[model samples]
Structure formats: structure tokens, C-alpha cells
Target: MTTFYILVGYLALLMGLGLLSNRFFKGTSADFFVVSRSVGSFLLLMSIFGTTMTGFAIVGSTAKSYTDGVGVYGLMASWSGLMHSAVFFAVGIKLWAVGKRYGYMTQCEYFRDRFESDRLGYVLFPILVLLVIPYLLVGVIAAGKFIQPTTAGLFPEAFPMPNLPNGNPHPLNGGIPPAVGGGVICLIVLFYVFFGGLRGAVWANTFQTIVFMGTGVIAFYMISKNLGGLKAASEAVAASDFGAERLGREGMMSKLQFLSYCFVPLSVGMFPHLFQHWLTAKSAKSFKLTVVAFPLFIMIVWVPCVLIGIWAAGYLGPLDPGQSPNSVLGRMVGQLVHSPVLTGLVGAGVLAAIMSSLDSQFMCLGTMFTNDIVMKKYGADRFTDRQKIWIARGFILFVVGATYLLAIALQDSAHVFDLGVWCFSGFAGLFPLVFASVFWKRVTLPGAYACILSTALAWGYLFYHDILAAKPAGVGDEEMLVFGMMPVAIIIAISTVSLVVVSLLTKKPSEAIIRKFFV
Candidate 1:
């Protein structure tokens, strides 16, 4: 009853924020799509922070740290936040300057206008859809996982486990009806986002960030207290051979993979939604100033999660067969936290963290698919805002549906942390295209397109081998494949180099195009 009340209160707060912000977001597509380019640095900072430190990672990071030990701390280097900040400082400011100069509303618009190529929009459309859909699935899976167990007790005798062909019980414990936890959360996100648009997303993101961090901090303190303080936890870890042995070579690699996650913020920080957020700044000075604060935000948010992961390791011992450290944080909360009120609040906040990205991610994907992919390819330029809205709505439903199906299909034999790395790898493929588009003046459309295609193929090949193939359980250290951030980094390097070489060898992007984008 206490937990239920706490959850209700959290939802009420979120809905109130959505209702309050909805009025400010009415008007043009830009208003609906990008908050009318009026978001302040504070809003931008919170939005970026919330969206990047999403639910997929917040829970999974603890699990990764639990499984891998202290080595996973290197993953907290805040590469994504750093790179995202740098982009804001360097590339983002410039992108905003040009958007303001050209009255460009979207990244695809920027590409289309700068290159004098409607064809560029065609290329970007599919890329954005592909980039966003799988990523959104991750959030869906995270949310469903979090909510499933929490509310399971509610169903009780009504829940019945399904029988397999071999007569084993269905893997989902007592088979309650499908939770739709992810879908329910998405509907909440859509309610605020549909009416309030980008402003709503920003407002909700700011509030959500505060709630998420506050809850996480409290939960961390409780977790640490229950297990003894951090010093005691450290001593506990030292005493346990689990830290020294199983967490050995492969453990070191997992740490490397964690460190590699830094690139995500770097690459995704420049993503369309982020690019639009950068453009909304009141001034270039504010944009530049905001970068310095993000590193601190990353540290404050991630450190507690990491510490909690370490604590879980000592308390839980080696993860049980078929159990993941990713699940450890929630399980620990379920087992250790005495106060159901705080536990439910913390759980709701975690779900908010997951949905924070789900909303923006789907929105971005919808916009890209509609504006960049579908509209450019087939539709006339004079399409109405209503049409675009409907298209976006349809795409949102599609994205959620696809994610739900994928999560169900992949429920068995997959780890959340590993799935996260795979999704991140897909985005890493975009890093070169983004860099070349913004920085290298000579990077031709063909070169950019080739780089995008090749990087994706290379990334897919790696996933197929490491994830799809029947390799050993811990086969080829986690870092060697999906978790290995460096491999994606290396691919980015190669793709950029290859694009540069190919662009020089081929016809240059028109001189007019170069001057417009560079200027």
C-alpha cells in the first residue's frame, strides 16, 4: 500500500509537469518538434543528462559492475558526456550557428540545404530509423524487466506458468499476463510529449532527472548502509576471491568495454534531437558554458550506481547461473530495502529513466523516418503539419511494437548489458558520418553514404559472430566483441579515413555546398 501510494505520487508529479508545459509548446512544427528553438542551457543540460543516462544503462551498469568488479569503474570516464559536451562546445555551437543562419529546423534540413541535395535527406531517413528502433527496444526491455517482478505479487493465484514442449515451466516465473509495463510507460510519455512536444520532453526530463538522481542517491545510501559503509564494502570486496579470480582476464576486458561506452555520448550527443537542443540555446556563450558542468553531472550520477554494483558483488557473491548483475540492483532493492515506500519510489524513478530516452528516441526516429526518409523519398514538400504528426504517431506505435516483439523473442539467452553494447555499436557507426559532415569540408555525399553503409555492415558482422554464433558462455572476453568499445572506435577511425580518401578521389561536394556548411 505504501509503495503504491509512492508510485501514484510520482506519476501525478510527472503528469502535472506535462500539463504545465503543454501550453508553451503550441504553434509551429518546430515548436512541437524542437521546442521552437527556445530551450535554455539548463534545460538542455538536464535533457542531455537524463536521456543519455537512460534506464538501459542505469540498471545495467550496476549489473556490469557487479559481474566485472572494480574494472568497470573505468567505464564511468564519461566519454559520452565529455564528447557530448565537446560537441556542444565545438561542433554543437557551430551547428546551431548554421541552423540559425539558414533557418534550418532539422539535421536533415541542414543536410538537404547545405548539399543542394534532396537525395541526402533520402539517405538520412533510413539511417535514422535503423539507428533509433533497436535502441528503443533496449529501453522497452529495461522497463518491462523492472516492472514485471515489482507488480507480480499483485496477480497471485491468477498467474499460471506456461508449459514448454519438454514440460518445463515458462521462463518468466509464474506466467502472469504480459505486463505491458513498457507500453504503459510509453503511453505516459506520449501523453505529455504529444501535447507538449519538445518543451514537454525538456520539462519532464528536468523533473525526471531530479527525481531519478534523488531516488538513486537515497537507494545507494540505504544499500551501502545495509551492507556497511563504502570502506567496509571495499574491505569486503578485498576479502572475497570472487574479486581476484573470476573477475580476472575477462573481467579486465569487461572494464575495457565499460570505458568504451564513453564514445556513445560522444557520437550520440550530436544526434538529431541533441542537435536540435543545441540550436535552441539563447546564445553561443550559454552553449559553451554548459559543457563544463556535464562532466560533474556524469560523475555524480554514475558513481553511486558503480558503488552499488560493487556492494552487490560482495553481498550477492558470484551471480547465480543464468542471473545477471544487471538484475542485481533491482533484486537487491527487492530483498534488502526495508521501506517499501522508498523501494517503489526508487523503482518508479528507474522506470522514468528508461522512458526518458524512449520518448525522445522514438520522437527522433519518427521525425527522421518521416522528414528525412519517407517525405523526402515520396511525399511532396507541401505536406501539412497534421500529416507529419500522424506519421510521427504511426511510427511511434511501430517502434514500440517492434521493440515489444524483439524483447519477447530475445528474452531467453541474452543479457541486458550485452544488448546495450550491441545497440551502442550501431550508433558508433554514425560517428564518422557526423564528424565528416561537420568538420571535413571535402567529404562528399557518396563518401559519407559509403562510410555509413560500411560501418553498419562491419558492426553487424561483429554482432553476428559474437552474439548470434554458438560461442562459449564467456567466450572471447566481453570486451573482444560487443562490449569492446575500442572496436567501434577503430571502425569509426577507419570509416572516417576511408571516407576522406574516397571523397578526395571522387568529385568533391560542390564548392557552394562546402562554403554553406563550413560557414
Candidate 2:
């Protein structure tokens, strides 16, 4: 009961912060979309870092490390820390400059102007939304899974998860149901997003970034102490059948597959939510702090989660039949923390990470729908600025509702880490197009079309096939490697090839357009 009240109090604080930020809303579409580009360097850094280090970084990393070993850090976090910073330096700064000068609020707008094809938004909008939904689900799924076990036994009779009549304890018994937990989070996020818009999101993200990172360090120290220090935890693994292999990447995954993961981090280049965050920067100089500080932040957040996961393998032993990897972090925290108030704080940190990313994604998608679809295709002159804001608000309502429903439906089949990798893969495959648009003057409208279409097709095919393909007869995750590499390698190749080939064969953009962007 104390833990539950603490969580409730923490949630109230987040909601209050989000709503309070909305009091600054300027009531214009541009203000609502990008906060009139008035953000400072420190705020910009916090907002960008907050949106990027999501549930996938915290909950998903820990969950996957339990399954695949400590190499999970190398597979995504190390590569992400390096590549994401590079992308911020090379891609993010330049986009911020162009977006500010052109009054652009979304990526689709930039692509349409770069290609001289209004219809390009029509094609690209749906594809970007499709990729982002999975990213949103990662947050929702993480929060729900994290809450369930941490709150268990507090509401034993109130929210009892199913158990055998034989009195055997189900791993999830007495935990909050995934739907109830996920729904409460979605509603809180939606309220702030709906009322405060992007400005609200940025403010909330800054608060969340501070909370999660600070609490994460505290949780790490406490959890390690509770487990008899890091040395004892490692020794536990040393004694178990898991052995020293958990310390390294050996035998858990193929070297080629692991190395090929470098391409996955490229997804940041094309994230619509990230594009909006970049556009919010007041100047190119604002990016300096973000680019410089991002890697350190990533290391601080990721190292703890991954090490805890590896340690769990040693001390916690095997998961039961009904237990999912997502439950590991929650169960471990709840069991080891012992102090109710401290346990709730740890739970809030996890939820903070999840909600920070969700706010950005929700705002970005709603802003995209309004700007690209309603304003561009439907004729913006017909609607007033107030109506435009409401349109965005209404659409945000629809998107969050649909996402929550899907998050519930897919909870059984999809886990957070793998689903996130696949989502990022789709975006990475589309990176060549964005990169060329910014750096290459010769990229043609046909090339941009080919890039977007081919990425959609390749990603759709690969994802659908992965779903339909049979897993091993035993209980293990089996992904079909394309020539012994993850599917992202092939999808990226297909997208890059089609982009370069079709551009050379097609007519280039006019000199006026080239000079507008490049010169």
C-alpha cells in the first residue's frame, strides 16, 4: 500500500509538471508544434536526451541482457552512444539550421520541398507513422510490465493475476494487470500532450530525464548492495551453470549478426520525433551540448541496466513458464529493495524513462498528421489556427487510443527489445534518403520515391515473414538471418541500392531547388 501510494504521488507530480508547462502555450500551430523555436541549449540537450533514452534503453536492455548476455550493451548501447552522437553532430545540426530557416516543423515537410513533390508527404507520412507506433508500444509495454511485478502483493485480492488452484505461486500473482497499468500511463501522457502540446512534452521530458537518470544511479547502488555487492553477484554467476560465458558475447549470438547491428543505430537519422526535437533548437550552437553530452548520458543509463541483467542470470536463476523477460527487472527490484518507499521510487524511474519518450512520440505523430495530412492535403486555408490546434489534439487522441489497444493485443507475442530492434531497422533502411537529401544535390524525386517505397516494402516483407516463420520446437527466439546477418543489413542494402540507382537514371531536381537546400 505504501508503494502504491508513492507511485500515485509520483504520477501526480509528472502530470502536474506537464499541465503546468502548458500554461505557457502560445496558442498558435507553430508554437504548439515546435514551441516557436525558442528552446535553449541546456533544455535542448535534456529534451533530446530524454526522448532518445527510452524504455528500450532501460527496461529493454536489462530484459535482453538476461536472455542474450552482457553483449546486449555492445549490440545497441555502445553503438548507439557513438553513432547517435555522430548523427547529432552531422545530421541533427544541419537539419536544425534548415528547419529553422524554412519554418519547417516536420520531416515530411522538408522531404516534400526537397523533392518538389507534395504527394511525397502522402507516401512518407504513413510509413513514418507505422515505424513510430512500435516505438510508442515499447514505452507502453515497458511501463505496464515494470509496474505489474513491482506493485504485486499490495493488491493481492484486488488485482490477482491467475494462479493454479493447487496454491502454487504464479510469478505474476497479485500484480496489476498489464492493461490497467498501461492505460493509466497512456492517459497521463495523453492529458499533458493534449493540453500542453510540444512545449509541454519538452518540459516533461526534462523533468523525467533528471528523475530517471538520478534514480537509476541510486537504484543501481542499492540493488548491488542488496545482492551482496557486485563481486558476490558475479561470483554467484561463476558458481552457476551460466558460468563466465555470461560475461562476454561468446556463443550467445553470431559475430556477424552482432557486428551488423551498427546499421540499427542509423534509425535516429530518420526519426520523425527526433526531427521535431532538432527543429526546436534555437540555433545550431545549441546542438554542441547535446552532441557532446549524449554519450556520457547513454553510458550512465545503460551500464547499470545491462549489468543488473547479467547479474540476474547468475542470482535469480531461470524464469518460470509464464514469466516474461520484461518481468525480470520489476521482480528483482521488488524482491530485493524490501523498503516500500524505495521500491516505488525505483518503479517511478522506470516509468519516467518510458513516459519521456512517449510524450515526444505522441506530439510528433500528432503534429505530423496535422501539418502533413490536414494542412497540406486538405487545404490549410480552410481552417483557422485554433481549428488546426484542435485537429492535432483530436488526432493525438485517436493515435494514443489505437496504440494502447495494440499494446495490449500484442503483449503476449511481442517483447520489448526485439520489437524495438525491428522498429529501428525500418527507420534505418530509410536513412539513406534523408542523408542524400541533405548532402547530395543530385538526388532526384524518383530516387526519393524509390527510397521511401523500397524501404516500406522491404521492411514490411521482412517483418511479416519473421512473424509467420516457425520458431524452434523448444522455447527460444529464432530470427532468420539474411545471409547470416540480421534483416536490417539487407533492408538497408535494398533501400540504398534503389535510391542510388534510380537517382542516376532519373532527372535531377532543378538548379533553383538545389541552390535553395545545398547553397
Candidate 3:
């Protein structure tokens, strides 16, 4: 009960902080969408770092490590630490400069102008929304899974879910349940995002980053202490049946699989939310800290969660039948830590990491709809600043409702890491479109269309066949491969080839359009 109360109090404080940020709101669509392009170095770094470290980092990493062992860290964290920073330096800074110069607010706007095609915005908007929604779902689902187990038995009487004839609690029972947990989080994020906009989101992100990282270190230390120290924990894992494999001594992942994982980090270069964050920078110099320190921060959040998951294998043995691997982290915390206060603090930390990304995603989607669809199609001159803000709010509300419904419908259907990887793959496949649009002077509008269409077709087929209809085997069971490689590698290959081949075969863009982007 103390833990539950602490979690509630932490949430309330965040809500209050979000509302307080409304004082800084400048009463314009620009302020709402990109914080008036006035964000400085420290806030920019914290906001970018916080937004990138989602439930996918904390919950997904823990679950993957639980199933696939320590090699999970090598699969993502190590690569992301290096790749994410490199992308920020190579791509993010350049985009920020163009966005500031052109007064652009969304990626679709950039593409529409860069290609000199009015219709391209219409095509890109829906695809970006489609890719972003699944990423949003990953965060929502992870939040529910993390909250459900941590708050178990705290409100059994008040929130008694009726059991079915077979003795199950229908969807869930005893704990907070994924539906309720997810709803509360969605509402809280909506409250802050609706009122304060990007400023609110960034401010909340800065604070949450501190809470999560600080408490993350605390959780790591306490968990290690409880498990009889790091050395003893390693010894316990060594004594387990598959100890060497868990410790990465037996080459758990194939060489092809290990190498394929490298492409996954490229997805960051194309994340819409990240693009929005990039446009918020006050200057190109604001990005210097982000590129330099992002790798170190990845180490801060990922190493502990991965190790904790591996330790749980030796401590708790096998998972119960029909249980979600997503619940591993919460289950470990709830069972291992006796103090309710500490448990509550740790729960808040985990939620901090999850919700940090959710607000940015929710806000970025709204920014896109407002800038790309509503304002662009209807004409920005027709709508006042206040009306534009409200329009964005309305669209965001619709998105929130749709995402919540989907999350409830698909609870525990897949692993958080796998779902996230699929979503990232879709974006990563489109990286060629962004990379070429900036660097390749000969990239024509037709070539841009080719890249988008090829990525969508390839991603759609793979997703339906591999992810939805015939679900791939779980992590450690077998690799989910198309022609003996990850789906993203195939998707990227198709997208890049179509981009280059079509650009060469088709007529080039007019000199004016080329000069605008390339010059």
C-alpha cells in the first residue's frame, strides 16, 4: 500500500509540473509544437535522451535479457549508444539548421517542399502516422505490464475483477490490471501535453530523466545487495543449468543475427518524434552535448536492467505458464524488495522511463496532424493561432483514444522488444528517403516516391506474414528471419535500391528545388 501511494503521489507531482509549464506557453502554435525553437543545450539533451529511453529500454531490455541472456545488451544497448550519437551529429544537426531556416515544423512539410510535390505530404502523412502509432503502442503496453505486477493486491477489494468459470480473472485481477494502468497513464500524459505542449513535455522529461536515472542506480544497488552482491549473483547464475549460455560464453546468437542487429539502431535517424525534438533546438551548438554524452547515458539505463533480468533466471527459475515476459522486471522488484517505500520509488522510476517517451510521441503526432494535414491542406492563414492549437489538441485526443483501445485489445500478445523492433524496422527501412533527400543532389521526386512505396510494401508484407499471421518464435526459441536475415535488412535493401535506381532512371528535379535543399 505504501508503494502504491508513493507511485500515485509521484504521478500527481508530474501532472502538477506539467500544468505549471503552461505558464511558459507562448500562446502560439509554434510554441506548442516546438517550444518556440528556444530550447537550450541542457534541456535539449535531457529531453532527447529521456524521449529515446522508453519502456523499450527498461522493460523490453529486461524481458529480452531474461529470455536471451546477457547478449541482449550487445544486441541493442552497445550499438544504440554509438549509433544514436553518430546519427544525431550527422543528421540531426543538419535537419535543425534547415528547419530553422525554412520555418518547417514537420517532416512531411520538409519532404513536400524538398521534392516540390504538393501531393507528397498527403502520401507521407498517413505512413508516418501508421509507423508512429505502433511505436506508441509499445510504450503503452509496457507501462501496463510494469504497473500491473508492482501494484498487485493493493486494491483487490476496490478493484475486484470477476473471475470466469475457468477460474481466471477474465483479462486480469488482483493488481491494477493493464487496461486501468494504461488508461491512467494515457490520461496523465494527455493532461500535460494538452495544456503545456512541447514545453510541458520537455520540462517533464527533464525531471523524469533525473528521477529514473537516480532511482535506476538505486534499484541496481539494492537489487545487487539483496542478491548477495554482484560477484555472488554471477556465481549463482554460473551454477544454473544453462549458465554459460546466459553469461554469453556459448555464443547464444548467430553471427548473422548479431550483425543484423546493427541495422536496428539506424531507425533513430527517422523517428518522427526525434525529428520534432531536433527542430526544437535553440542552435546547432545545442546538439553538441547530445552527440557527445548520449552513449554514456545509454549505459546508465540499460546495463542495470539487463543484469537484473539475467539474475532473475537464477533466482526465480522459470516463468509461470501464460505469463508475460514483460512482467519480469516488476515481478523481480515486488518479490525481492521488502520495503514498500523503496518498491514505490522503483516503480516510479520505471514509469518515468516509460512515460518520458509517451508524451513526446503523443505530442509529435499532434504536431504532424496540425502542421501537415490541418494547416497545410486548409491553409494556415484560415486558422488563428488559438484555433490551430485546439485543432491539434482534438486530433491528439482521437489518437490517444485509438491507441488505448488497440493496447487493451492486444495486451500480452507479443514481447515488448520484438514489437518495438518491428516498429523500428519500418522506420529504419525509410531511412534512405531522409538520408538521400538531404545528401543526394540527384534524388528526384519520383525516386522519393519509390523509396516510400517500396518501404511500405516490403514492411507491410513482412509485418503481416511474420508478425501478425504466423507469429515468429520467441526470443532464444529461434531467429525471426526472412532468407536467413532480419526483416529490416531486407526492407532497407529494397528501399535503398529503389531510391538509387529510380533516381538515375527518372528525370531530375528542377534546379530551384535542388538548390533549396542541396545548396
Please list the residue runs of candidate 2 whose C-alpha ends up more than 4 Å from where it truly belongs after superposition: 169-174, 414-418, 470-476
lDDT of 3 by residue, 172-246 (tens): 456898888999999999999999999999999998999888877788788889889999987898788744367
Comparing 1 and 2 by lDDT, which wins?
A: 2
Which ranges in model 3 have alpha carbons more than 4 Å from their true place?
A: 161-173, 249-251, 412-419, 470-479
Model 2 per-residue lDDT tens digits across residues 392-494? 9999999999999999988776555466768888899999998998898889999988988898889889877676566557736666588889899999999
Better of 1 and 2 by TM-score: 2
On a 0 to 100 scale, what is the lDDT of residue 85 in model 3? 91
The number of residue pairs in model 2 that clash at the backbone is 0
Backbone clashes in model 3, listed as residue pairs: none
- Cα-based TM-score, every candidate: 0.88, 0.95, 0.94
Q: What is the lDDT of candidate 2?
A: 0.86
Total backbone collisions, model 3: 0
TM-score of candidate 3 against the unseen true structure: 0.94
Candidate 1 matches the true fold with a TM-score of: 0.88
lDDT of 1 by residue, 275-380 (tens): 7667666677767446888777777767888777777766778876767566788777877777887778787788778877777776676666666666766663
